[model samples]
Target: MVWPPSLRQLEFGDGFTVRIATLKGPPSLQQLWIGHWCDEHIARVGWPMSLQQVFFSGNFDQPIAGVAWPTSLRVLSFGEKFNQPIAEVMWPASLQQLSFGGSFNWPITGVVWPVSLEELSFGDGFNQPIAGVVWPASLRQLSFGNRFNSPIARVMWPVYLQELSFGDAFNQSIAEVVWPASLRQLSLGRWYDQPISGSIFGVVWPASLRQLSFWCRFDQAVAEVVWPASLRHLSFGVCFNQPITTVAWPASLQQLSFGDRFHQPIAE
Candidate 1:
């Protein structure tokens, strides 16, 4: 079916399959969202020149050829079941953000990422170690899902990164890891129930840090940890039972949120 030339966005829900190669439309289209489809179906499609974002929530089990990608695409998100290795796929130079959903277990250590990429995210089942991965220098934000338990301590983080997050299975101590000086926000991995005794204190947090969040299973007392003077926001997860007042609050703190187990009274 021929869509209106003025259409800018197209979205197809589950169980719906549309042959984009057969569809007729103008180059005004910017976003394309589709359900399960094979690489041949995507390769055959004539993508609009103006398309910037492509989101696929289908079963992409086959490898995607470089010709299947649109040069104008800036953001690309794969489905939960897409397990194809992206090493063979030629990422567009314009890409800024890339995400891998569930079931994507390919190792990205040797894969070349687009230099323009600023944000990178991983979903469940991505357990491959990224220690030797050559990360894009332009990266600013990074996140991982529950099953990602890679040892990031050996990875050389981009100096420009501002936000860093980890998955539930990542219980490795980050106290000795050299964090970037540009980091502003940090989110610890969930399911981390270990005591934070003096581990956090051993690391030198960047002065640029503004936000810090604890994982859901963190129930340790952080009173011994020295909070950064540049911190503005702090949050605790569900199982954290430590009293909020026991820790020395930073003078720059403007927002504080505690978990359900914290019943301490605010002295303000």
Candidate 2:
């Protein structure tokens, strides 16, 4: 097919195979989504230098150690069926945002993430332990999959991380985890019912924290929790019926929500 020189984006339907040596796409193509189930050798489809975003949303599960990823690629993603190991694949230097699909449960401890990465998110099936994984210094936002309940006490969080979110099954003790000083937003999982008493963790949260959210089943008391002075938003989960009369609400708080179960009297 003769692709138009002015064509900028292209997404192939499923069941396509790369029998040609090169895709011969237009020079103006900046984004490409390949959805072929049988194409194992992705490097055979020569990527244009102008391509900035690439997505693999098919059954391409072959090891990609020898694939020559494009230099200008800034965003890359895979679909829910992609479960290949990427520990040996050299990632693009300029890649910023990367997301794994639902079925990617491969071990990623040895994978060297891009140095310029800003946002990285794992899919629901990724529950790999990451104690040895060194996240990039430039990462600002990071999130785990729904089944990820790995211990993060020994993991070194990035210094500039701004937003961090855990999945629904993560109910591990966070008393020993030292959150990043630059963290501005934090969200705990739905099943996180652990005690975050100030006596146990002690002024642990960074002063830069602006938003905090507890999950649906979190019914812990906040009277002993140390609310950050810079906190602007706080949310307690649905099952919380804890008394707030003695709780010290932060002076900087602008938005406060005691989930559906907060019907206790203010003077209680």
Clashing pairs for predicted structure model 2, backbone only: none
Candidate 1, residue 156: the lDDT equals 87
Q: Which stretches of candidate 1 lie over 4 Å from their true place?
A: 1-3, 18-25, 36-41, 194-201, 243-246, 263-268
**Tens digit of lDDT per residue, candidate 1, span 210-232?**
99988688887676777789999
Which one is best on lDDT?
A: 2
Name model 2 segments beyond 4 Å from true.
Answer: 15-22, 36-39, 201-203
Write model 2 residue lDDT over 156-262, tens digit each, in one string: 89899999999899888787888889999999999888777766654378889999999898887778888889999998889888878888888999999888888
lDDT of 2 at 163: 99
RMSD (Å) of each candidate, 1 decimal: 2.9, 1.9
Best by TM-score: 2
